[model samples]
Structures are given as C-alpha cells and as structure tokens.
Target: MIVLAILTGVLTGILSGLLGIGGGAIFVVAAVFFLGVPQHAAQAAAIAAMIPTAIVGVVKHHRNRLIDYRYLPYLAAGIILGGMVGAYVANITADIVLRRLFSAFFALMSIQMFWSSFRQGRKAPAKQQDHDKH
Candidate 1:
C-alpha cells in the first residue's frame, strides 16, 4: 500500500511537471481505483495534493518564462471563487453522481485532445512547407 501510494504520488508529480497540468485527474483515478478510496474522499485528497505540487510547478514555470503575469490576477480570482463554489457543490453531491460526472468529463476531454492532436498533425506538413519557403 505504501509503495503504491508513493508510486502514484511520483507519477502525479511527473505528469504535473511535464505537461503543466494540475494532475487532479491522476490523483483521483489512483486514489479511487488503486487505493480503494471513495470518490468524494479521493477528490478531496486530490484537491489537497494540488497545493504543494501547484506551488512547485508554478515556480518552475515562472523560471521558464511560461507564465503570462498579465492575466495572473484574473485567473487567480476566478480559480479561488470557482474552487470555493465547486467545493461547496461537491460536498452536497452524491458520490456516485460525482464519479459519473468526473468520468464523463475525462472522456470528453480525452476525445477533444485526440481530435486536436490529429488536426495539428495534419497541419504540421503545411506549416513546415511554409517555413521552408521563407
């Protein structure tokens, strides 16, 4: 159990750093599926896990000049407000319903990512040709 927990945390950190993602989905999936955690509990754990990881990731991103400071205020405000509201709503929602909703969200997001990748791949050759001409 401890080994699995450590492995999950390590994997989450890797994904977060490599992809600039929050890694909430990774935590939630690992906690619920492998650790036998309840959906609501897993979600709460994932939210908690975000704090340290987000702080570290942000520092690295800032160092790499990947962040646009101009939009920071608005983004921070929205995240804080939305997170509070989301937490409140999530607390009132049933576990099964939340699980189903999370599953559907991931499914839709995965499909969108795949479609975007395909479109980008198709455009790459044209972009390369244009670049070569210049």
Candidate 2:
C-alpha cells in the first residue's frame, strides 16, 4: 500500500508538471479506481496532496519570473471563498451526483482540448504554407 501510494504520488507529480494541471485529475482518479477509495474521500485526499505540489510549482514559476504576483491576492481570495463554497456543496450533495458532475466536467474539458488541438493543427499547416511562400 505504501509503495502504491508513493508510485501514485510520483505519477501525479510528473503529470502535474508536464501538463500544467492540478494533481487532482490524476490523484482523484487513481485513488478512486486503483485504490478503491470512496469518491468523496479520494477528492479530499487529492486536495490535500496537491498543496505541496502547488507550492513547489508556484515557487519555481516565481523564480522563473513567470508569475504575476500582483494578482495573487485577488486569485487567492477567490480560491478561498470558492473552495469553501465548493466544499459545502460537495458535502451536501449525494455521492452519485457528485461523481456524475465530476465526470461531466472532465468530459467537457476533454472536448475543449481536442477542439483546440485540432484548431492549432489546422493553423500550423497554413502558417507553414505562408512561410514557404515568403
């Protein structure tokens, strides 16, 4: 179990770094599907596990001058308030409903990503063609 936990953490960290995504996507899915953890518990654990990764990411981005610190307070304020509200809502919601909602969210995101990727692919060829003409 410990080994599995470590492996999951490593994978989650790698995915987070490579994808610029919060670790929740990998962590929650792994915990729920692979580890047989309950959905709500998995989500809570994912949230907890994300803290260190998020801090490290922020530090690295800050060091690279990629972060705009001026907006942090505003972003933090919204995250804090939104998190509180989301937690409250999750707690009150049924497990099945929460699961379905999560699935829907991911599905929508996947569609958007596919659309964006295809759009970029289409533009790339056009840009290359124009460059060749020049």
Using alpha carbons, what is the TM-score of model 1?
Answer: 0.87
Q: What is the C-alpha RMSD of each candidate to the true structure, in Å?
A: 3.1, 3.0
Q: Candidate 1: lDDT of 85?
A: 99
* lDDT of candidate 2 at residue 131, scale 0 to 100: 84
Task: Please give, for residues 1-134, the per-residue lDDT of candidate 1 as tens digits.
Answer: 99999999999888876886668889899999999999999999999987887788689989999999999999999999999999999999999999999999989998999899888867788778688679
Show model 2 residue runs off by greater than 4 Å: 125-134
In candidate 1, clashing pairs total 0
lDDT of 2 at 10: 92
* Candidate 2 local Cα displacement, residue 40, angstroms: 0.7
Supply candidate 2's per-residue lDDT for 120.
80
